[model samples]
Target: YLNSFVDNIDEMKEKERYLMEELKNQENNFLGIKSICSNKVDRVEEISRLKIEMNRLGIFLKNNQGLNDFSIDDIQNKIKEIEEYYVSDEEINNLQNKINEFKSKIAYPIIEGVFGILEENFSIIDKKYEEAIYSSMGSRSKFLVVKNEKIGNELLSSNNSSISIIPLNKIKPKIVPGDILRNVRQLGGIPITELINFDEEVSKAMEFVFNGYFLFENKENARKACYDYKVIGVTLDGTLYDPKGTLCGGKIICKNIIFRRKDLLELEQSFKEKKENKRIYEKEKYNLNELKSKICNLREIKKAKNDIQIIENSIKFLNKLIESKVDYSSELSSLRQNIVKKIREKEEFLRRKNVLETEIFELKNKIKSKKEDEKNILKKILQLEGFRRQSEIKISKKSIGEREEESLELKRKHLLQNILKSKSKISKLRELLKEFKSGKNENSKSHLPVQFQEISDVLDDFKLSSNIFNVDLKIFDVKKEDELKKELFSVRKEIEMSKNIKK
Candidate 1:
C-alpha cells in the first residue's frame, strides 16, 4: 500500500509541470500575434499617407502641364507677331524685278534723236576728267560728240529746250599767249583745257570753253592772280573769276547726269545688298522658330516621361509591399481585438498630431504676416518721417514775418510809397541845385548883378578846389545850399521810414 501511494505522488508532480509549460507557450504565441497586428497597422498607415501624397503630386503635375502648354502657346503667338514684320519672298521677287527694270533703262542713251550715234559715242572720255568736263560744258557733255555739222544743226532746230548742241567745227580755240601761260604757271595756276582729256575732234570745243581759264588751289590766290594777270581764273573748288569781274562760286556736286554708268552700278549694288539682308533676316527668323519648337517639344516630352516614371515607381513600391505581406489567420481573437483598439488609438493620436501641427503652421503664418506688416509699417513711418523733416526744413527756410504775419504786406506797400516819395524829393532837389549852379533859376533872378557875378566866381573856385581834392563839394556850393539841405532831409526821412517798416 506504501509503494502505490509513492507512485501516485510522482504522476501528479509530472502533470503539474506539463500544464505550466503549456501556459508559457500560449503566452509567447499571444505576444507574437500582437506584434504582427502592430506591424500591419503601421504598414496600412504608411500606404494611406503615400496615397495622399501621390494625389497631391498628381494635381501638381497636372497644373504644371497646363502651364507648360500655355507657355508654348505664348511663344507661338510671339512668333506669329514677328512674322508680320518679316519680308516675304513675293515682295523680294517684286523688288528684284524693279531693280532689273531700272538697270535696263540706265543703259539707254542720254540724248535720243542723234543720227547714227549709238550710246557708246557719248562716253565720258576719261573718268578723272569727268568733273572738269562737266563743269566746263555743264549739260552740253550729254550731247552726242559727232563729226557731222548737219546733226548739230538738226538738233538745234528741234527747239527742245532740254537739248544742247556743241558743234566741234564751229568752235574756235582761244590761243593763250606764251607770256600769259608763263605768268599763270609762276602764280600756281594751270590752264583748265590742260586738266581735261578728250578726243582730238572735241579739242577745239574744249579749248573754246576753258582754254583761257586757269585753275588755282583756292579762291583768294585765284582772285589775286586773276586781277594781277588780267586772265580768267578757276579755283579747284569750282569757283570761277573772269577778267570782266564776273564771279561764280559754290560747292561742286558730282551730278548723276554726268556719271550715268556709275549711278546705274551703285543703284544695282544697293538693291542687291538690301535683298541679301532681307534673305539673311528671313533665314534667322526661320531658324529661331525651329529652335523654339524643338526646345518646347523636348521639354514637354521630358516632363511627361518623368511623370510616367514617378507613377511607375509608385506602382512598383505598392507591388513590393503586396508581395511582402504575411497571413495572420492563426492569431488569437483577444490579440486581434487589442490590435483593433490600438489602431483606433493610433488614428486618434495621428489626428490630434495633425491638428496640433496645423495649429502650429497657422500660428507661424500669422507670425510671418505680422512681421511683414511690421516691415511695411516701418517703411511708411520712415517715409512720413522724411516728409516731416522736409516740411520742417521748408518751414525754417521761410521768412518769419512772411510765414506768420498778414500785416507785413501792408507795411511793404507803405514803405514802397515812402521810398518813391523820397526819390521824387531827391530828384527835385537835384534839379533845383542844377538850375542854381547854371545861373538859370528864376527864383534867384532878383539878386544884384555883382552878387550873381560873385556867386559864379565862388562856384568856379569851388569846382577847381573839388577837382584838385577829388571830393564831391558840389552840394556845399553857395548857390545851392537850400536845395542841398532839402536833399539831406529827404534822405534822412527815407532811412527813418525803412527802420519803422522793419520794426
Candidate 2:
C-alpha cells in the first residue's frame, strides 16, 4: 500500500517542475510586455540583470526572456551594435591599458584574447588562417590549429616539436569554454593526441543554444574509455547540431537513454500485442476477488439453512413426542377400562365366596352340636347298663335278661340317626370350600383369571403400533428445497461473473 504512495512522489516532483517552469515563463512574458509598453530600450542592461536575478524563477521563464521586449529585427540589430561597441577605437583606446592589465591577471584570456595568443606565438599559423587553411583556436589550453597540411609539415621541420600538430577536421565542433584541442608528443618522437577534451565543449555549446543537453556516440568506440560517457556534438554558434544521422529519421537517445520519438513509437507498438494477455490476467484477478466474496456470502446462507434445518428437526422431534404421549394416554385409558372390568368381576366373585363361607360356618357349628348330643347319649347308656347289672344281681337271671333286651334296641336306633347327621355336615363343608377356592381364581367374568403380565404385554404392543403410525408433516421437502436453492445461487454467481468480464 505504501509503495503506491511513495511512487507517486517522483511523479509529483516532475509535474511540479513543469508547472513551476510554466508559471515562470508567464511572469517573464508579462515583464517583457511591460518593458515594451514603457518604450525603454536603454534599460536593456537592467533587463539582462533581471534574467540572472530570476534564475531561481526557473527554465521556462529564462527561455521566454525576462523584462526584455524586442522584435526579431530588434534582437539582430542590438547584437550587431554590441559587437561594434567593443571594436570602436574610442572605447578600445580608453580600455587598452586595462586590457593589458587584465591579460596579466588571467593565465589564459577570454575568447577575445585567443587571437592575441596566436599572433604572438604563431605567425605562420595566422597565414594559414587568412588563407582559410587554419583558424586560431580559442580554448583555456594554449594550442594552435594549422589548417594547411604544408604548415603542419613546416612546424614539424622547425623542430619546435613541443607544439603538437594535427589535421583541423579531426576536432569536434562544440568546444566548451575551457576545454582544449591539441596534438602533444611523447617518447616516440611522433604526435599522438589530435583531440583533447573536445567532448565537454560540445556539451556546453548544446546547452547554450538548444536550451537542452545531448549525448553522443561513435556507437562502437564508446564501449571503452569512460564507458558510460557518450559523445556530444554542437555548432560554432552554440546551437546543438544533431548527430549526423539522427535528424534524418535515424535512431537517437534521450536523457533517460531511451530512444526518442520514432523508436518509442515502435516500442509502444510492440506492447500492443500483449494487451490481450494483460486483459486476461486482469479478468482472472477480478474473478478471484468476486469468488471470494461469493464464498463468504455462501457461508452465511449455509449457516441460515442449517439453522432452519435444526429448527425443523427439533419441531419434528417435538411432534413425535406429542404423538407418543397421546398414544400412551390412549393405552392408559384402555388399561383403565380393563382394570375396571376386572374389579367388577372380582367384586362378584367376592360376593359368591362370602355366601359359601357363611355355609361353611353353619356346617362347622352343626357338626359341633351333633358331637355334643352323642356324648350325652353315651353317658345315659352307661348309667342304664350299671343299673341293669345291680338289678340282675338281686333278682336273679330273669330280671337281668329283660333289661338288656330293651337297652340294645334304643342304642341301635340312636347310632343310625347320629351317623346320618354327621355325614350331611361334612359333605356341606367340602362343597363350600370348593366354591371359595374357585372364587379366589376367577377374573373379568371368566371361569379362569386373567394374568397381570398379559395385560402389560397388550398395552406395549398397542403403543408400538401407534408410534409407528405417527408422522411429523412440517419438513416434507426441506432437503430438496435446500439443494435447489444452492444450485440456483451457484448459477447466478456464474452469470454475474460472466457479465463482469464482458464489462
Each prediction's TM-score versus the true structure: 0.28, 0.15
lDDT for position 39 in model 1: 61
Off by over 4 Å in 2: 1-333, 397-503
Cα-lDDT of candidate 2: 0.38
Best by TM-score: 1
For model 2, how does the per-residue alpha-carbon lDDT over 1-503 read when each residue is reduced to its tens digit?
Answer: 33443445445455546545655555544443344323334344444444453443344334434323534454445444433322334543444544444445433323211222221222222221121111112221234334445655565576544654433434433432211111111111111112212233233222222221222223222122112222223221222223333221222221222112223334444444344444554555555454454444445444545655545544454444434434544544555555555555545545554655566567678889999999999999999999999887878876676786556455444433433443343344334334434555233224212322332333353334335433122312346435433543453354344336435
Model 1 regions more than 4 Å off: 1-144, 157-161, 256-503
Candidate 1: residue 341 Cα off by (Å): 95
